[model samples]
Target: MKNLRLERCGITQYDEIFYNLSYDELFRHETDAALPDSERGVVASSGAVAVDTGKFTGRSPKDKYVVNEETSRDKIWWGIGPVAPTTNNSDNQQISEETWYYLKDLCLKRLNGRKLYVVDGFCGTNEDSRMRIRLVTEIAWKAHFFKNMFIRPTAKELEGFVPDWTILDACKITCPEPQRHNLRTPVFVAFNMMERMTLIGGTWYGGEIKKGIFSVMNYFLPLKGMGSFHCSANMGRDGDTALFFGLSGTGKTTLSTDPKRLLIGDDEHGWDHDGIFNLEGGCYAKCIKLSPEKEPDIFKAIRRNALLENVVMDAKGVVDYSCDKKTENTRASYPIDHIERIVRPVSRGGHPSRIIFLTCDAYGVLPPVAKLTQDQAMYHFLSGYTAKVAGTELGITEPKATFSTCFGQAFLFLHPTRYANILGRKMEEHGSQAYLVNTGWIRGKYGEGERMDLASTRRIIDAILDGTLDEASFETMPIFNLQVPREIPGVDSGILNPRNVWKDKADYDKTCRKLAGMFMAHFNNFTDTEKGRALVAAGPQLDAEADAAYSSEA
Candidate 1:
């Protein structure tokens, strides 16, 4: 076992200073890191202290312990080193070691009254070591909201913990009273708003998820549409411009901020009285194999305050996004401060010019993008779109499908219907256009990787930005298909049919039947259920007469 042997800080040094227990005894004998003082004891007393391997003397991190894959499976091993960490695939900014200690200092200072510590709680012994350390400091400050931040001690640990829903119901939340304590450091403020107040953290890796940070803790407020979901809505001017929703990889950031179009907000946004206003100060970009060439602007935005997650490291522990062995959300979460329009308190008001939903259809049969009629819009909205996370693909080989309404669930704090209603009402009020764009592979089956030309994708974006597609004559596609005018510039007219993604006509028909079966099955789960039906009823009709007019291979 890799143990912490206190050579300098002696036993009985400050025992029972606050909590009626021996500090030295606790530290020396406890498997748990450091214990917190009970109610009647000392308040948080620790300051920013650097993480060292031992009480004294410098030691080579690699020499202190060995990485034994064959043994020590249950032990946690923190990478002890002296140098400041460089930015990873997910982050472009490197936090200094001094700044790192400030993060611990914040925990020490805030723990006295806090009840939680939001953290990345995935299955990693390395991550757990850090989690334990966070607790040691959390109890010192006793900050009121740090509970549920670390690992659950027992099954019943959740017994009295406030349910996530309760926090959502608490309407007005401001920067905690004295405002956020100015540690003069930028430790990530790990808070969840998707469905409740959750412990959230953003650790830096290689612009990807690394240790213990959760990306899907959106708030749960049902203001409109349907059940709860993660949403990011912000209004720039009249709020009648656009709202982007998609999973991590889909080009929400890329498409929404079309170079020709002005950007309202980048990442987290709250839909308020005026419109959508971004709640964050930065964007968390995924950085697998990221290069200045592929996404120059995003690449350049990383600097100070960005936290990289789960990027493979080099011999020097520097991030290497080129490696795909790590988790899929190899993400870089930086404050929204980088984007110009990010609002304070993250609230805004405005109208939208259009409502655009994005999807990455790996199958590639879908158009680069297609505008929708009212009915068609609702149908596509409910169907949603998903592609497997880069490394998360199953060995089963077939690309798995995940359906989520209004794609950006990682930040939405309301039911899906709530967002849908606001969007629908606003679209009607301002005569906004609704469209769906597919940013995945094209001209090949899901795994073949014979991709759609990015040049064509650019052209499609150009058409959307310039309003060329708005005038195209879109016919209602028959048999559960959205009306796609036969020949649209920037997209191949021939591949509009679902059957195009498959090679043999027989295989095409089988997949279509299977997909249709899934649709029917999911649809059956709802009988007059919430706004889901309203969305369906309001969408394009599956015309019985049109079913026979066109071939499945049309």
Candidate 2:
């Protein structure tokens, strides 16, 4: 075997950096050498290695930034407005070139005289469109994490593979000059599109590393005439493919990993002229309350090579997937091959026949499932509506409504309407069908209403895939203009219409009107263009009486 070293890449500053260590080597170093005593490993019941992220569990969205430079300045979307920011930051502020170089120098300086780990990998599964990536980290576990999260190259492919993008993660290096760098805190995650490099410092959370790469793919894929998505995809026995779009806690991973279907990829994907391709080589599943019975594939994937993040464990090395003492975003990263029933090729699949937009509507106004018109589909695709439940993040004590355009507002590089336009064109050209499924509450608000049963949701999805739901009688929702089915197998006909299930008819009407108003308010951000106008016109409509009633109630 050939030796791995940074010298191969012409980096003379670091002489002791270990390049492209195997999984076994990474695991050994992680457990026995790289980590501190407090960050030591624990063996899970299934034999996987588990470790806590400490203090910062979930992603720090606020800390993420894109450097403002001439190379990609005009093409980039800047600042959050009536429309949500593409970066998902409240102040999508762009730092100066001096600030970016300063941070980069600081990160590189921190790695001096320190042992580093590097992993060479690919981002896109489509061989023709994939970008080579080099991940350099200060911790052994991060190298292991990248090894599991990214597509691994075979020995032949690794012989002379030069990276197109490089990510330098010096997680322990805090920026003391936060004020000068225009950072909110001592931590920073910044990406330079022109340079094709990502810098991470002051935080050891694993998600920063994953999402940093995702942001880069989001920027470049669209420019290449491909649509990058934050969704899970799968193909059926008959080669029928489906895509599930949702934010975290919306069951994108769980719903797409069907026992009957073959998993293509979870989390990130790209759609191009040929078909849909997995942007990642593995699954980073949320492990909160995980169970063998509920998700056997993901549960079993938690084995020797899987990397557990922020999960709570007992002194005896038994993992408590149900424990949230750390955070609700506990996660596990494993290669797609870990799942026994995944699709062959595992990187790319046929163009999707169906696209499902998932939302956990806390207001309980949307029906369980609704067929969308082409215009309505574009509208909802741009809206990307969902509710954030409590415990998913700090300071969120109840379900809060959120609108992330294209279902991934945080990682977008261009305006969301641009992505929506591409999706609309593709769906129209391919003659694909779209549906809206609410994996959320019904009949009442969050605290009062019962969550939509997982079994019922699954049955609904099965019906859609099998072409049964299309045969059912459909009724038009009053405000949203959504086509709601009157019946579905394994689901009560009453629950098909959210209003029918509500005990208080007046309350349901009021809640529905309020939600409609909220939708209108959010859509106002994109009403400047002709396409935007059409989309706004396709959304829910409020009558005079309902508007009056809602106003009086407010």
Candidate 3:
């Protein structure tokens, strides 16, 4: 059996062969090179990984491990060469389906029944150790998910960008067969590595290159996982549990590290039999020439173990930080392994006391923070309400409807109902609850439109933190259509009335007309769809209750 040889830390190094080779040459040798199969079929290159190929007497495909050597002093870090240019045969040069059949054998043959941690990444040794570690761990994760999946390392555009990754490692791991199982997600962490690959990623991605290629960086892992990345924290009441859900922009890292609460995990997380745990060692923040003032936490965290993303630089190559270039994907990705007290492999061991579903609402209608009920949680969860990402020159330009479970859609394999069922059951079982805090806006009276102040939102969150809202009396108020509380702390109870938050009484009527029209379009008018009809039916009753709750008694 071939064992992974590690050298003493800081003492050993690979032969440095990757340094001399041109990117083009390496791609040529790997992708263009061919091997013969016993079935008289020709195949593209095979994995250059070191393994015990002899132990595999198995005949099926399954989950396997692709090791990312971050701490091994003895392991060799092989640098990757540039991608070979697509030629007359680019499309013709796909890896044979049978290749996956072989890949399945490789992964299962190697890591079956062995508790392992597979790191995922782009190209391990293409540039520096920072980049390598990120890419490796990402690869490990992807490899772990798809037993027979063969990952090709490249940052070039093929299909799209993959972000549905978690430094989510396993505990009692076992790979039975890499048999043909339909994988819906990609093990995405690199630039378009999952581009051509459909399942685990998306089609739109970053254009600017980091280091050299747009591979995933190792610095994204939180330090808690015990790696060498940065820019993360672990905060909550006991520091044992916390919520880690957010959109691409709205300060996921910023708020998660509030000095008040201990940080949990970022990027990738898994709900296991025990609890939830993070897979990586650091953090990955989006930066396009970021400055300390704009992102001070991340700025400070980018030290020895950090890998800067597609950041634009000045003549001196220093980051500008203020520039918002839609053209560039200035990013800062790290591994959770960098954090010191990271919660590992967060299993769905139990329900969370508080489940905060974050949003980046551009319409800004609701308050930044308002508590929601369990049913409301489910409602909003199904609503998957989020504004369309402001489309870029290359993407959509307006806010659109995006509803996803918890808030991620990239790598989810199961139907959203699966997560919903889990959350509902767990919340009920644990007596923990769900809340819908509209971190979006406030509708004032008459034509005077008003936006909720962020400070007030913070205060609201603060109140939630101290349990002041819970102690206060809550009377369920209703919106005309939805069962929203008329009075939520840090929120105006008037929105319960259709007339509130509009420019004029006329506007209120117009708005209701619009909402009803939208509803009718979606089958709200049908009595046959009782479930759908019930939603609208719950409207007025919910509004009255909410109004009573908000009509505070001094």
Candidate 4:
């Protein structure tokens, strides 16, 4: 095998490189070879390799930065509003050309003399639109992770396959001179879109690598007239495709992995003139509390060659999926083919006939399921409404309302309105229906109300896909102006209106008005644009008299 050395880049002083090693080779290297103290190779009960990412188990979104170069400065979204001190503030600083070069040099230097592992793969599954990628990491497990996460090339396809983009993962390297580097922390995850290269250092979290490539796709795919989505998709027996959009904890993965439906892609995808294509070759699913009964496909997918991150296991290698002692962001990375029923070719699928926006509403004010008009769809799409449940992040004990534009704010490159407009146009052209489903609290607030039963949520989703809900009588909800169905097959009629389920109707009304106010307040961030204005008009309306009456009662 020809070792592709980075010495050609004029930075590597050493000549060692392991290029395109097979799964067995990587496993052997990680398990038998003398690895770093930070890297631990543990075998799970299913014979899969499991590793712990110390300190940083989840993504450090604030640390992610995009170089504001001349070619991409105007095209990139530099984030709006005030920067929060504790949040990932990638938009806060636009690194100078000199600084980017300096960081690249540092990353390459860190790789020198280290046993580098390189994995060559493709990003998009569509043969027509696929982009070749080469990832160089300091650890063998990361190489294995990337191999599973990205589309692998066959022997014939791998011959002379030049990468269109490259990622240098120097996870173990940390900058000792933070002041000289002008960094808030010793670690950094920076992307230079102009160079089509990403540099990651000072963190061991593998998600940074996965999402870094996604960020690149989010930027470049739009210029090609493709809509890049942070959503999951699957197709039915009748060739009907459905897209599920939501953030972490919002059932995007679980719902999309329907046993009856053929999985298209989970997490990220790109929609073009033809149809949708999977952006990845694998699934990186949240495995905390994962059980076979709840998600058999995902549960069974964790077999040999799968990589479990931060999952607690006993001395005998039996995994305890319920444990979140390490971190709530426990994950499992496995190849897409691991699942029994998946769309063959895994590249492309027909345009979706139904679009579902999944949200976890802690406030319990939103309806269980609501049919959205075109305008309302665009409005909700931009708002990206959801609640950040406790324990997902540090210091967040109670549910907090969050509005990430396009449902993947951390990975967005262009203005959110751009993606929203594309979606609206596509929905209109294809006559696709949109629905908002809240798989969260019911009757009262987070502490007072119980979660919507997963079985009920599944039934609602089934109805949406089979067109059963289309025949049900609809009623307009107050404050939010949502058109909710009066009845469904499996769900209780009393809970449909939300207010009926609450013992204190006045409290429910007050909560609804409060949520409506929150929506209007968050919408103010985009009111300057014409599309934003239209979306605002489509949102929930608050009544002044009702607000005063509710306030007086309080």
For TM-score, the strongest prediction is 4
Candidate 2 per-residue lDDT, tens place, 96-137, comes to 889888988888787766777888999988887888999887
Q: Where does candidate 4 clash, by residue pair?
A: 62-88, 62-89
Query: What TM-score does each of the candidates earn?
Result: 0.57, 0.93, 0.52, 0.94
Residue 534 local lDDT, model 2: 76
Q: Score residue 296 of candidate 1 by CA lDDT.
A: 63
Tell how far residue 391 is off in model 3, in angstroms.
Answer: 5.6
Better of 1 and 4 by lDDT: 4
- Runs of candidate 4 with Cα error greater than 4 angstroms are 3-11, 80-93, 389-398, 545-554
Is 2 or 3 the stronger prediction by TM-score? 2
Ranking of candidates on lDDT, top first = 4, 2, 1, 3
Per-candidate local distance difference test? 0.40, 0.82, 0.35, 0.84
- Report the lDDT tens digits of candidate 1 across residue range 318-342: 5556875645445554434444443
Output the lDDT of residue 302, model 4: 95
Give the lowest summed-lDDT range of ten residues in model 3. Answer: 44-53
Q: RMSD to the native, candidate 2?
A: 3.4
* Residue 310 error, candidate 4, Å: 1.3
Candidate 3 CA-lDDT value:
0.35
**Clash pairs, model 2 backbone:** 479-540
Report the Cα RMSD per candidate.
Answer: 17.0, 3.4, 16.0, 2.9
TM-score of 4: 0.94
